[model samples]
Target: MKRTFLLFTMLTTPSVSLADNAVNVVSWGGAYSQAQDDAFNTAFEAQTGISVNMVDADDPAVPLQAQILAGNVTTDVASLGYSDATRLCDENMLMLIDPATLRPAPDGTAAVDDFLPGGLSDCFVATDVYSTIIAYDESKFPENPPDSLADFFDTEGYPGRRGVLKEPRFTLEMALMADGVPAAQVYEILSTPEGLDRAFAKLDTIKDDAIFWEAGAQPPQLLVDGEVVMTQAYNGRIFNAAVDDGKPLKVIWDGQIYEMDGWVIPKDAPNPDDALAYVTFSTDAQALADFAMQISYGPPRKSAASLVGNYKDTDIPMTPNLPTTAQNMANALAFDNDFWVDNLAQLNERFAAWLAS
Candidate 1:
């Protein structure tokens, strides 16, 4: 395993130390955060002797921006979606992260060259690429399972409540796909007013049967509790349900929407130094690989791919389950950060009105 050397003073153990001596990381909770805690936080604290205060958020970007706008940024580091990172960077709410400062591949390859496209942006360094996929409890569909995005909206066919993310981003994209828009054209269509209306129309079909979820952990639990027979969820959450919790859940990759999630430092971070160190260490090749092994997300660094062997503590190879795998990408859509960055606020307002209607 490769480790990066950081020139920071350390403590032997990670106790609740002074706030200024610790790194406060905000991230999406559930299995994804657990994976980070296990693979990155534990190892980060051990190596640097700096305490890590990991906190949960439905979407870290929301509170991150809120805090920044309020001029009371308590968060040192945050895990954010690529679009959010880009948007925040544009608004000057985040610190600029130089790719050259990131730890490079073990073979001495430069960090800028080793990271995948869109992995190392001005304000974000991607740790993993995760997908939003449709997963269901197998027992709910003993005869015929939902295998495509269309089936998720087919209330009469699937015949149970569907789990929908409360946000407009993934929901809008999936709505278009279910309406027969090709993955390649989702953004082009969404770039227009008619396309947005059409996508919402498709969602209207399932709105009555849709059970909304805000947190990453809720989808799988909704499935286990029989509240939602089929639901849209982060692939890692469903992977954990099936592999770790031994739930009889199945993921449908047919219309998966994949995107990179990574680290960002608030411009007014209380502990900028430790935050940078944590981001640097956690996004290194070994750290990325370790996190991916614990979850199904694909590590963003090319070197991390070779380092990723199997799911932590299991013989299951991590590659096949990754969103970047060939079979999974067959009908996949890469979430369009550019489009979302431009129209999120407007669409979110529209979505709110639609929900209330």
Candidate 2:
């Protein structure tokens, strides 16, 4: 069950007309970008005679917003974080996705059921899954690695500097988990004001020993330079750092926060139909698996897991980051994007205040 998309770029011709036959996509820049460029962008063009103009972006939200507000919707499809997608949805800045047009299952059912609940909505569909976990320098902690988030904050026992993401969502959840809340109860505990305060109080205990990482690429560098023995990081970036530098690093999947990025169609997009086709094609099981294998991000498509090869006799599928097994994924928490979307500004302000204090 491979999902295929036609990708064509007008490389040779500078003045190609895209009015009727092309789709414009905007996406984050990284290995993910390369994989999409290789798999979908190339294939889509070869098959459909439709050229794709992919706009590489470090932050696509502002540009997308500007384009939409200006009534000059150049981007037909976009890959955005859940929060960004929600913001666009709330602003009525995106078009509703029609799941009926998606590739059908072997049983003749719509493939929409293959996606995780809350991972997609009327206006967006999840494209990839990434985890934020405790990544440690394996060389430094060769004998005994930190097994869980609890050990990450156990300074007296581990006895080293640690790093945590500067964002409040995962950081607060990690703090709550460290304070002994079970993985299943994390979100329930943080939904109330008292619970939020409790998590912050627990975080305050580790504040002095924790180095706050503000950027996605910073934690890996901090780990490589020995600035911190353990830090919270995206599984992909840490894995890339380790493979690139030949450094020994291990990710503790226990209590990891699994977050997803989604494909969203901007409101008033020039080619909404083609954008829908592109999204459906990109999420096909085979294409999803191919992209995941090239990058560390996991695909939400149910069949994508089977496409991954086995590293050993273990049932776990081999990926660039740690294997995403049923057990590992079972304990993983899905970050609440709705909560984050509603509270990001205030929570970020509070986080900054807490950091300064």
lDDT of 1 by residue, 1-357 (tens): 232212112211122233556887888777778888889988888888888877777678877777777677777898898878888898989999998889989999999999878898889999899899999899988897788888999989889999999989999999999999999999999999999999999999999999999998899999999999999999988888898889999999989998898999999898999999999999999998899888899988888887888888879998878887768888999888778768999999999999999
Backbone collisions counted per model: 0, 9
lDDT of 2 by residue, 1-357 (tens): 122232323212122235687887877766667768765677777777767777666677777887777677678888898888877888899988877766754355566887765567878788788888889988877677778788887887787888888778799888888788887888788888888898889888778888888888899999888899899888888877866556788888888888788799988887878888788888777677667766677877676677755322344445545435566675678888776767788878988899899
Error of 1 at 228 (Å): 3.4
Q: Identify the leading candidate in terms of TM-score.
A: 2
User: Quick one: best lDDT, which candidate?
Assistant: 1
Single out the weakest 10-residue window by summed lDDT for candidate 2: 7-16
Against the correct fold, how does model 2 do in TM-score?
A: 0.87
What local lDDT does model 2 show for residue 157?
72
lDDT scores for all predictions? 0.86, 0.75
Model 1 whole-model lDDT (C-alpha atoms): 0.86
